[model samples]
Target: MRALVAAAIGLAAAFALILAVTAVGAPSGETSPEPLLTTVPGPKK
Candidate 1:
C-alpha cells in the first residue's frame, strides 16, 4: 500500500512537472490554452 501510494504520487508529480515545463518552455508564436471551456446543455427528456 505504501509503495503504491508513493508510486502514484511520483507518477502524478512527474506528469505535472512535464506539463509545467512544456507550458513554460513553449517556443515563439505558439499558444497552449484555448479561449474558452466547452460545455453543452443537455436537452430535457
Candidate 2:
C-alpha cells in the first residue's frame, strides 16, 4: 500500500539522518583514565 511505502521511506530517512549525525559527532581516539562515575560521600557515623 501507499501508506506502507511512505512509512518505510520515512523510517529510512530518519535512520540515514541519525547515521549522518552520529558520524559527524564521532568521538576521537582519546579516552579518560578515570571512570565517569564518582562515589558519593556517605553519612558519617
Candidate 3:
C-alpha cells in the first residue's frame, strides 16, 4: 500500500512537471489569434 501511494505521487509529480515544461516551451501565439480570411465573389462586382 505504501509503495502504491508513492508510485501514484511520483506519477502525479511527473505529470505536473511535464505540464509545466510543455506550457513554458510551447510557442507563444498572438494575443489575438489570427483571424480567418473568407472570400466571396461579389455580385459581378
- The numbered model that scores best in lDDT is 2
Summarize candidate 3's per-residue lDDT along 1-45 as a digit string, tens digits: 999999999999999999999888968675667766597647774
Clashes of 1: 0
Error of 2 at 20 (Å): 0.2
TM-score of 2: 0.56
Error of 1 at 14 (Å): 0.4
Better of 2 and 3 by lDDT: 2
Ranking by lDDT: 2, 1, 3
Residue-level lDDT tens digits of model 2 in 1-45: 999999999999999999999889966798889788688869899
- Per-residue lDDT for 39 in model 3? 78
Better of 1 and 3 by lDDT: 1
For model 1, how big is the CA root-mean-square deviation? 8.6
Estimate the TM-score for candidate 3: 0.55
Can you give the lDDT of residue 32 in candidate 1?
65
Instruction: Report the C-alpha lDDT of model 1 over 1-45, residue by residue, as the tens digit.
Output: 999999999999999999999889857796768676587758889
